[model samples]
Target: MSWVLGLSGLYHDSAAVLLHDGRVVAAASEERFSRVKHDAGLPVQATRWCLAHAGITMADVTHVTWYEKPLRKFERMLVSQVANFPRSASAFRRGTFNWLTEKLWVKAAIVKELGVAPARVLFSDHHQSHAASAFYASPYAEAAVLTVDGVGEWATTSLYRGGPGGLELLGEVLFPDSIGLVYSAFTAYLGFQVNDGEYKVMGMAAYGEPRFVDEVRKVLRPREDGAFDVDLSYVSYHWSADQSYTRRLEELLGPARFPGSGFDPTTAEGKRYADIAASVQRVTEDALVAIANVLHARTGLDTLCLAGGVALNSVANRALLTRGPFARLFVQPAAGDAGGAMGAALWTWHEVMGNPRTLDTPVLPGPGLGQAWDDATIGALLTDLRVKHEVLAPDTVAVRAAADIVEGRVLGWVQGRFEWGPRALGHRSILADPRRADMKDRINARIKYRELFRPFAPSVCAGAEGRYFDVPPGGEQLAEWMLLVAPVTTDDFPATTHADGTARLHVVHAAANPLYHALLTEVGRLTGHPVVLNTSFNLKGEPIVSSPVQALATFFRSGLDVLYLGAHRVEQTGSYDG
Candidate 1:
């Protein structure tokens, strides 16, 4: 009975994973438990929840694994900051203070915080953890692995071969030449936060043409060897902390977009920004495709397991698959730094313990791997909150929810367990009829209060994806987890389709989430389309609600017409009007 507690934190997207004898039982991000967006703390709340959910304590853990090699990471930072000299004084001060105060003692902190023996604590390389999280968790017995992120210790991008033997490094692209960093630099230049706002750039790209590709090529150009080069003169992310790009970038790409000013594509300035975003997105896709070509040539494998923050770019993922040589892709659902927690645990289980990998796990294992509450517990909480609600029979919960959707009501859904990844699958999602012309505006303006260009996703029944979306044949697993964008083939569901005629598709299967699949079935029976607009269940700038109390607060504060909480239903007329 080997129990491994894997952890990743202190940078961003901190998370915890509990693996029972190498089988992932529970995994969640600290942001979900702490109600903080991109929480970078120790993930104490998440760790405790994983242990409690697994019915174990730290004493039962056989090993505690950390995702990053701190000393090597610090060394990279120290050397780079020194090389940049007086220009990096501010970043150096902040980095040195953080390292000396807390990050330097992460191993000791993990031991003391979890009460694990000193010998039980182990550390894995950042990229290796990313690779392991994707390959080991994938259904593939063997595959080509590619991990690309802003920076991990020193490696920015790495290629590996995964088999029963173990993960073997084939080649790597070192720091400062990172595709992820180049994209993030453009993200900041376009008036968005680096890690948090990269997706916004992806969304904005769809609105404009790739008119600035030549200018973007100046920032990051692909070499004939399939490696890309980033010009440091145009970027400051290597040393500076506050700013990601230098003045040279602004001179080359025009003025940076102001952060708070509204984004309207009709305006010339907005159009310019959109063009820049489109150019960068195109360049990013080209870079990834080139790298994938190289990896495929080296490994000559048909299946690819992709991991890290860069893999979260669904649009690029689709382009990479269609343009590159790989026939299949199994992207880790939680591909950000948070997923490294799972990787660390699985790496120790397979590579360290010499256990054989299995094919029992499906590629699209559902996102219902987090905390959950039953009808009885939720009903009690609703009662305690003095909120008006009705508890429905188990069988009719989905039926009533489907009826509401058919009646053009925006519903809040809280069924089964919360999701493990960033995107809300069916579990904790805001549901609305995709066929409604005003659905996107109503949800984005009234409920989400987000940018209009930011598109909502579509959650389609597994078999119904091809009816509306042209999902590529080799990208089923990626589509299943909402990790890739596919063209929308139908005009019936306009809300989920983006300006570029594609949607970030999430495929729901009955075996993984029977309740969600049942709800979709009922929807299909009612409206003849099992698809619906699905987005995370929270307002902008906040983490998704984890508990019933948080869900209730969000329900009343937003323009949700009804709430489907567990087996209970609370409508707008039931003394709870937003």
Candidate 2:
């Protein structure tokens, strides 16, 4: 038996993945275990948990692989600092200090932390990890792979061909010219954190027109062949530490939004920010579409595997499917650096081990690939807390939870393994009825405490997705992972529908998450529509709840009416309404 441990960390979204032969035994981000949002430390807890879950330890693993070539990345950083010279003094000093102290000693760190042999530590290229994460796990045996992110070692964008043979490197767009960084620049300009706030920019785009596309084009121009020419003068990510944009970007886009300032779209200032966001999103979607077309032409493949942080743009995914050349799109669920860990493992298995791509590998393991607690564990915790709760029967839990939502009661739901990606899915999700018109505002104000423009998603069973959303052919794959945004054809479910009449619809599959699928069915039976509002079971800036203790604590603190921890239930009033 061959056990391969894959790790990606020390920058952001640190994670660990355990792959045995062709099976993904376990995968998890450190943030979940560490309870630190985007935790960048070594994935010590996550890696240990993975090994424990598989009844093994680091010593039992055949090899340990890192997601990126750290030395190559150091080379990029070193060259970039020298090229930028005095301008990069502070950023270089800080970066070099960290690299010298920690990042450069990755092999030593892995060996010390995991107690692994020195020679067993392997490293894979960053883009290759991103490519393997999507392709090897996709349903298509042969497909085109495209990975675009802010920067990975040196490549910001990469293209590849995947088949039973192996991945083929087609091309790359190096750093200092990245669509991902360009979008992140707008993210910072709009007064949000770079990597964490790009999704907010996507949501903010729906509120305004793409009126500033011309101005945005001046900063990032897309090529006919699906690449972009980014103006480095207008951006500061390459050199600056305090900000992603420079005075030149502010001059080009008008005054930047002040950080932490009140933003009301009814005001002209907020409207301007929205328009800029819309413009950036439009340009980004167009550039990705162009890239998809070029990759499609290059590979002549019907399916495309997309990964990287940029692929998490759900709205752009809808565009790529409807307007691009590919008939199908498969975006990695863990599309960010966290997924690079899983991809590195898969890359080692197939690309390095020379294993044939098997039908089993293409099944696309469900997102419930992390820590899980059984009913007994949850019950024991409730008892230990001296909390009044009911031990629900496994068969009746879904129906009772559906009834709670139907009665306008909000539920903090925790079940099975926490999701493998950033999305909450049905497990570790807060649920409310979408039919309630005020549900979105209520959750945003009282529960999530997030920006008003950030809309909640809807969860519907896979086959029933068409009834609520105008999902196109092959959209099921995207919908299963919350990777695509689709138009809500009707106003039947109002809360899940965003300003642009679209929802990042999550399609629950019976095989993948039977409890969630059943809950949706019961919801449809009670409300005549299966759709329900779903959001991650975390407040604005926290990682999703991983354990029953976290779930119970969050439920009591938040405005949630009830808590469902596995087959157990806890209600605030101590009275069962259903």
What's each prediction's TM-score?
Answer: 0.98, 0.98
How much is the lDDT of residue 233 in candidate 2? Answer: 89
Q: What digit string (tens of lDDT, one per residue) describes model 2 on residues 424-542?
A: 98889999999999999899889988887888899997788877788977677889989889999998878889988999989988999999999999998988888789999999899
Pull out the clashing pairs in model 2.
none
Candidate 2's C-alpha runs over 4 A off are 361-363, 574-578
Query: What TM-score quantifies how close candidate 2 is to the native fold?
Result: 0.98
What TM-score would you give candidate 1 relative to the actual structure?
A: 0.98
Candidate 1 segments exceeding 4 Å error: 361-365, 573-578
